[model samples]
Target: MHEKQKARDVMTPDPVVLPEDTPVVRAAKLMRDQAIGDVLVTRGDRLRGVVTDRDIVVRAVAETRDISVTPIGALCSTHVVTVDPDQDADDVVRLMREKAIRRVPVVEKGHPIGIVSLGDLAVEWDPTSALSDICAAPPNE
Candidate 1:
């Protein structure tokens, strides 16, 4: 039997990433520039965490923290839910569902090689599901 499609097969290779010590403002800028909601935080090629736009808004701005001096690592979700590149895609979907998260980093030996979002999965692997339709829908903007 053929091996099931793994995270690597469906992941978005070369996902947006930044150093863990990146200033919050810079990190948020990168996310805006990339049109992405989240950016993977790294420490010299090693996966560190994920900083979402929401994190900046709630963890920093909402809290009236100094964005210009605060580093993303302090505000990012350090307990990031990650998937191995070789893991089955089904597992990734299940994890996302349980966590209610829309995206996960695909890692290999502690290094992030890609990301697999619900939208990516829906578009490429689950075209008939309602999620696919929702994910494939164009943004209001």
Candidate 2:
């Protein structure tokens, strides 16, 4: 059997984050700049919540709430579910599936150190070899 891959193997290291007090617009900006769908909300490295593009669209824009004036804390998903670095990727996938979550924060000693998304796991596992093919291919002509 293949050795189990740990969360550390697939998680993005030192993930870009925002403070709990950051406004929703700023968090959206950070996500856009990073080309990521979500960002971990932290307080000095301690995980607090998660903000996603969907959150902005649903809770702010769709609701006609002012993104620039609303704090991320108002829209972020608190009580974040996290995974340990040593946990197997399969287990992480299971947890995410059960929770209907697309991202999992990787934490150590009560502090977040990284993040993993569904896309991350897809690339790591390459179930259909799609990710492998993409990685093996050179830039598009």
Candidate 3:
């Protein structure tokens, strides 16, 4: 069903990212400022890892660690799974489901190009028409 849809159609292009050396607090601040859940960690143009708000809460704060001394690289999920910009959305969705991940980085020519989230797919698969129906109806109904 998603054969005709490209990653570009759903991916957030030119996403803001952080360097591996960025302090955890700074990364968190950037995520908050951008209103994004995840931040790609890069070394030059190469994708190194990814850090999410959950990572900070679960791996840092919950662990009682100091954010100032912690590098984002320390909490980042390295060797992240990625998708190609030209790949079909259905294939990407299947891959995400199998990996149990809500986000996937879009890469091209060995460089990070964009990112896609579960929300992106939800909207791509069905825009406000379907989403409104799901939201407007009572959960038990």
Top-TM-score candidate index:
1
Which model is ahead, 1 or 2, in terms of TM-score?
A: 1
The weakest ten consecutive residues by lDDT in model 3 span 132-141
Question: Regarding TM-score, does 1 or 3 come out ahead?
Answer: 1
lDDT of 3 at 135: 35
Quote model 1's TM-score. Answer: 0.87
lDDT of each: 0.90, 0.84, 0.84
RMSD vs true structure, all candidates: 2.4, 3.4, 4.7
Give Cα distance to truth, residue 99, candidate 2, Å.
1.6
Arrange candidates, best lDDT first.
Answer: 1, 3, 2
TM-scores of the candidates in the order shown: 0.87, 0.85, 0.85
**Residue 69 in model 3: lDDT:** 84
lDDT per residue for candidate 1 within 50-111, as digits (tens), equals 98999999999999999999999999898889999999998998999999998999999999
Cα lDDT, model 1, residue 111: 91
The C-alpha stretches of model 2 lying farther than 4 A from their native spots are: 127-141
